[model samples]
Target chain A: MMEELFIALWVIMSILAIAMAIHAVLSRDLIKATILMAGVSLIASFLFVLLRAPDVAMAEASIGSALTAIILVLAIRNTKRFEEGGGEK
Target chain B: MMERYDIHRSIPAILLALLVAATIFYAFVEVGFGEAKVDEEGSVSNRFISNSTQETGSSNFVTAVVVNYRGFDTLGEVTVLFLASAGMGAIVSALPAGDKRKRPIPPSLILTAGTRLVLPLIILFGSYVFVHGHLSPGGGFQGGVIIASGLLLYLVIFPEWKAPHKALALSESLAGLSFAGIGIIGLAVGGIFLDNVISGLGEAGMLVSAGLIPLIYIAIGIKVGAEMTGLVARMKGGDA
Candidate 1:
């Protein structure tokens, strides 16, 4: 049924989201962490669409993913390089 | 000379989290209690479907909800976008020009050609979305972002391409001011905010029946598109 498919997709997306969040929190490299965070946002947006809130999904895709990615890249460029095995300052 | 406690950041964050949790709990309890009352009169969903056409002229319930019932909220959302754009521009302008780097080389031929081919169609589609917001699922925000994406594509393809800053600035400012101006005009004529004064509520299901909703959406589309494009260009300059 369609409901089962929705559930499957939700589960997969939730796992990806958790993994990305953990990577973002654990990573020492600022740029890599930021990119992971962007992926988390993108997964969240997809979940929003699945939950029947397309408008919120659109906003999340535009602002949460695209704009946040650009801003984080800029931040990484401006900051000192992250230590190889330590968290970003 | 080190401070004993760094209270500024921790206290505010803890307070914000507590506030959010409390509000969520309150909303849950309120909804639980309200559901019975809601169901007493033949289900709230039916009432919504029945009354929507009468109230807003649009068959699409979501569009009606966004453009009419919550017009004030949409106004606030657009204002937030405007403020964000202005803030980004201000931050970029404050950076030292000497620290800015030279523009990067031209993008790939495919990207350049694709952008040139698609930009006009993107703009056209965005305009279509805005004009049909009252009748369909698309709205000002959707159209605005579409327009912004086209400009962003152009920026990516042509590294040296600078958005005409002065024109965009003027357009953004004027769109924002005119949106407020229309609201003020409504107050002057109808003695209330956002009251549609120019057009009478025509036959239900007509394009012109929503009074000023379509006009407001068009203004929002223009303002958001200009502001977002300006923000991207400003950030590009700052990065350079």
Candidate 2:
């Protein structure tokens, strides 16, 4: 029963992860893309927690999602938000 | 609103990502789950589980493995982090010198007040995490980043907030050096690097039981916190 539940969880998490990856790639604004990646990180962290790796889960939640997003957003502070070669809205 | 994306340019990247993901999926399916199979009965997992508490005096097997069995790898990881922080510092320092950008306006009163209320509690929680790493779910890297996140929030709210550069640097250096010093002590006493020597492996499951594990964790916590804070401050352009 628990194994079946875990399988369901895995499917849900993977679908969310894939959707986020697609959204990240399609997002126009750089900051929005970074946020999408952070969402992906959050999902990954959740998956880690489900796998019983609390240590990796915490690290991923804090460092991978939060700080990495902050750094990426900061790096593009002086740059244009939208992509240079026009492709998406 | 939907953005009409030109998928052609992103095709290679997408394909690469899919390839990686598929490879990972295949590997996992091939390797199978440890909990599901329990293949290595009398080998690594059993030894780590059964003897970790007795030998390393750490109830947390993860902590025991990280600080005791794989100690040198952790040191190398720390060194990599230090280099990353230093690189970040150097890059920020090279950004035109002097405060080129003016401080932005302060956040609203409610936001500031809320931040002030929560900041101390956040720090306390982070400290608890690393300090109790040997017995709990969190450890140095996790706790340190949490502390840094609190500081980051504080910085974002108060734009005029100046990071204590000298103090941060000094503490970062001290913590890193102490980690090495402890390793040296272990080498001297136990004949192996980062051995749980010098300090007695006290009663297991207790706060102060894991000998040098807690000390090492504390040092890692401080170093990681300081490094993370410095990086965030630099990225914020507070020190620029």
Candidate 3:
């Protein structure tokens, strides 16, 4: 039962991570993209925990999601909010 | 609101992505996930796993490997981090400072009060993490980042507030010096840089058990915390 649950959680998180990554790339709004990227990192951290590497998970959560997101958002704040190339918003 | 993608561009991209995913899926199936790839006997990782506690006196094998067996690598990593922050600081300072204008609206009272209330607890927790690094999941990097996050919160809450630039730099320098100093001492005593030369490795799982590891981690934690907070301050357009 525990093994099944672990696999289920892993599958769900993996899918979520992929979906978030796709959305993050596709999103025209830079801030929204940054947030989606952070979500992907958060999901990846959860996947790390499921894999039983708590150390990697903690680092991923803190550095990948928290600090990286903040830095990206700050970068976005300093630059343009919307992507200027072809796609219609 | 839906943004439409050009079919010509997206179709091939989608197909390529699917192909890559399929390849990855097939590879994972062939090479089983969560299974050890290396031989169980005489492997370096296997040796570390089996003998880390006995060798390094750190109950957490990860900590043992990171702060003991591969401590020089960690020192290099910390140096890289320091260089990164220093480079960022130089770049930001070199940039032309624009007209200094105050924030249009002041920070909310609730947020300011909340930040003040939570900041100490965050620092305490970060300290706890690094202090117990040899026995727990967390270590210097994570704890330092956590501490920086707390400082970041304070900076965000108070736009007009200035960080004590001199004090932060002092602490960071001192921490870095101590880390290198400890390694030099180890070299003199044990004939190896960053060796566990603290004579006695106390009972395993205890706070003081990991001899030189905890000390190195503490130095790393302080150095990292200062560096990251300084980075945040620079990014936030404050004096570092």
Candidate 4:
């Protein structure tokens, strides 16, 4: 029973990760892209937990999602929010 | 001259991405997966799983492996992490010092108060995590990052709040030194670097039973927490 749940969660998270990865890459607004990337990292962390590696999960959630998002947001703060010269003036 | 919606120009890039993804997927399969069992005798993982507690006296097998069996590797890893943070500080410090950020409007009073209230709990939890490394799901690295996340929260909420630079560096260096010192002590007493024989293995499943594992973890926790906090400050472009 638990195995089924794990498999389901893995499938759902994998799909969400792929979709979010595409969405982040396609995003014109850098801040929004950063948030989307965090969402992807968060999902990856959850997947790690489900794989029975709680240590990896905690590391990814804190370092990959939280710290990385902060860095990306700070970098975006120093630059234009939108992609330049992409019909965005 | 890349256009906003250049469909024709993007086709090759799309195909290249698909090809790269396919290559990665093929590599994953070629490497094999799920074939090794934790209890299968003669396997390296099996030995780690079965004998870790007895050898390291840490209930958490992963902590045993990280702090006891693989102490040198973790030390090198932490040193590399320190170098990265130091490099970050150097690069950012070279940039002209000024408040270049256009921060969002100051948070509302209720939100500010709530964050202040919750911060201590987060810090305490991080402490508990590292301190309980031998008997729980957390250890120094996870707990340290969690603590750094708390500091990150504080930085976002209150940009003016700053930890003293000298204090941070001092604690980090002290922790690193103590960690190496412990290993040297082990070498002197047990004829092996990072040996757990520096202290007696008191009892299994007890907080005090892990010999040198908990001490090493505590050192790692302090060093990691200090380093990560400094890294956050550097990335935030604070005066380092």
DockQ of each two-chain model: 0.23, 0.65, 0.55, 0.53
Give all candidates' CA lDDT scores.
Answer: 0.73, 0.87, 0.84, 0.83
Instruction: Estimate the overall C-alpha local distance difference test score of candidate 1.
Output: 0.73
**Candidate 4 segments exceeding 4 Å error:** B1-20, B30-36, B98-103
Best by DockQ: 2
Better of 1 and 4 by TM-score: 4
In what order do the candidates fall by lDDT, top score first? 2, 3, 4, 1
TM-score of each model, in listed order:
0.77, 0.93, 0.91, 0.91
Query: lDDT per residue, candidate 1, B135-219, as tens digits?
Result: 7667788778778877877876786786898898798788778778888888999887776675457765667766677787788
- Looking at model 4 chain A, report the run of 10 residues with the lowest lDDT sum: A80-89
Best by TM-score: 2
Candidate 2 chain B lowest-lDDT run of ten: B97-106
True contacts kept of each: 0.05, 0.70, 0.41, 0.51
DockQ result, candidate 3: 0.55
- Report the C-alpha lDDT of model 2 over B1-240, residue by residue, as the tens digit: 577777777788889988998999988987655364435678787788888888888999999999889989999999999999899788887876444454456689999999999999999989999999999988988999999999988987887889997899999999999999999998898898898883455688888798999999999999999999999898777454
Number of the top-ranking candidate, with lDDT as the measure: 2
Error of 4 at A47 (Å): 0.8
- Candidate 1, residue B214: the lDDT equals 79
lDDT of 4 by residue, B30-68 (tens): 655545577566988789888887777888899888888
Q: Give the clashing residue pairs of candidate 3, or none.
A: none
